[model samples]
Target: MIKHNIGLTSAEIGGLWEAFFQETMSVCLLKYFLHHIKDEEIKIVLTKALDFSHLNIKKIKEIYSKENIPLPDGFSEKDIDLSAPPLFNEPFALSYVYIMSRMGMINYAFITANIARSDILSFFTNALAQVTELYTDATTMMLSKGIYDRPPKISYPKKIEYIQKKSYISGFIGQKRTLNAVELTEIFFNIERNYFSILFCLGLIQVVKDKEIKNFIKDGKRISEKQINFFNEILQKEDFLGIISVSMEVTDSTISPFSDKLVMSLFHFLNSIDITLIGHALSMSMRADLSTFYSKVIGEILLYAESGFSIMVNRGWLEKPPQATNRKNLESR
Candidate 1:
């Protein structure tokens, strides 16, 4: 093990802090899924995911103890109901793991890159590898089950070509050029994620009793639908079919399987991810129309996320992460 005498940097603390909550939340979700899951293949994958989450939580706690940092009170057994009937079908559970593993891979890789402390770096490096394997596992299972939604395929170019006309980038007026491969890939992934988001909101809205929370989730579902229509319309104009995952489906169970706080926090997390993804799509888009669309939707998502954040704060659900000491306040005192 590499030893570091220096303390954790703010970035490292922030990364670990975020990871702790994420993993704890995962533990609750995976346990609930395990209770209702019948498919052995998907069960095995979820079990592995739960084990990884447990290991991550354990490691994070160790690091926190060594640093004399207080542990975060993330989601736990109280947040989930194992006795409640399945709120989502088996296929949806598998798809959830697949999508979440992909997100975990992205997050772990990003955190690992930003970490400088050797021990923390090693921890996240291992985490990235574990989540990558989980992603591969979930993907393989989806492919074998014929549930994986493949992106649209385009004909290969005959020769290396360069854009010579300014109209190539022009999308606001005249005939807009078809989406490039990069842009198509981004839009395709975003649509898949939004589909999951819609299903998530639909499931929660069915069981959550709080009127305000239910309305918030209803709005989230509507926003996802609008975003999906926008992306699908763009694809339709190009004669390419819009991507939709047929494997995902929510059950009619009205029993609340999770606390309102957990559901709201999960929604906030997903919305934040959506904003990050849309921002990236905006940067990669060369066409003004695509960029403009992404920017517009990003603003909508930010507003929705902010509302959810306020709810979490008001309900005492949001955990405060490590922060710099208030030196100015010390002088004032």
Candidate 2:
């Protein structure tokens, strides 16, 4: 056991703080979903996800209690209403778990690499394994149910060749080359994520009670649409078919099943994910036009995320994360 005499390092503190908030939010969401989900396959996935989330929260609480750090006021029972009606259908729920599990895997991998505390690293390591299984199961179920959107297939290359010309990356002035498989894959996956975001915002906008929150959701939907158009147009120009909309998955339920705070928090999280995905796309995109477009899109998403954060702060809904001690101020005092 780690000595309680030694306090947590900054990296440990930050990682635990972030994990606490994220897992807490996941717990609330999973609980709500568990209440409404009827499909056996989907319910099983949700149950497992909820279990993992609770376990993570408990582990973090133990660490906090040992270290004498105040626990974060993450989402709790008040943040959700178990009696609320179902907001998403079975397929949507499964797809959500699949996508979130994928993101969770990425997060846990990062957390596992960034911290020094062996205990915290071990916790996240297990978390990653759990989510990896969840993703596998969810994807298998989705494919069986014919709900999974498989990426477009391309013809196999008969021969491999090296790029001998400097013009391969040029898209601004001369004949732009057809999108390679890597670029196409990135663009397609990015647009596919935006479609999910747009549908999520569309559904939430129909039920959110607060006008400010509603408008924010609307703004998010608009941005998703704009990004969708931007990326889809690129595919269109290349004569490649684009992804179909998942809006049909959302129902016409006008009842608010989630608290406005929960909804806003989800929006904030999604916007952050969007920025990350865009940055990844920007790095992988070789053509100048795609690179420039991804850069601009990232800027737009950053502005939107900032506005959402301001709203969260003004409403007293933002929970501050752990920070380093202000040594200079403490010394002056």
Top TM-score model: 1
Tens-digit lDDT track of model 2 for 28-118 = 8888778878888789889989998988888888888987889989888998888766777767887788888887887778778887667
Number of the predicted model whose lDDT against the real structure is largest: 1
Candidate 1: worst 10 consecutive residues by lDDT?
166-175
What lDDT does model 2 reach?
0.82
Name the lDDT value of residue 313 in candidate 2: 94
> How much is the lDDT of residue 142 in candidate 1?
91
**lDDT for every model?**
0.89, 0.82
Off by over 4 Å in 2: 1-6, 172-174, 246-248
Task: List ranges where model 1 is wrong by over 4 Å.
Answer: 1-4
lDDT of 1 by residue, 240-330 (tens): 9877768567788999999898898888778777787788889999998888888889999889999999998999888887879999999
Write down the TM-score of every candidate: 0.97, 0.94
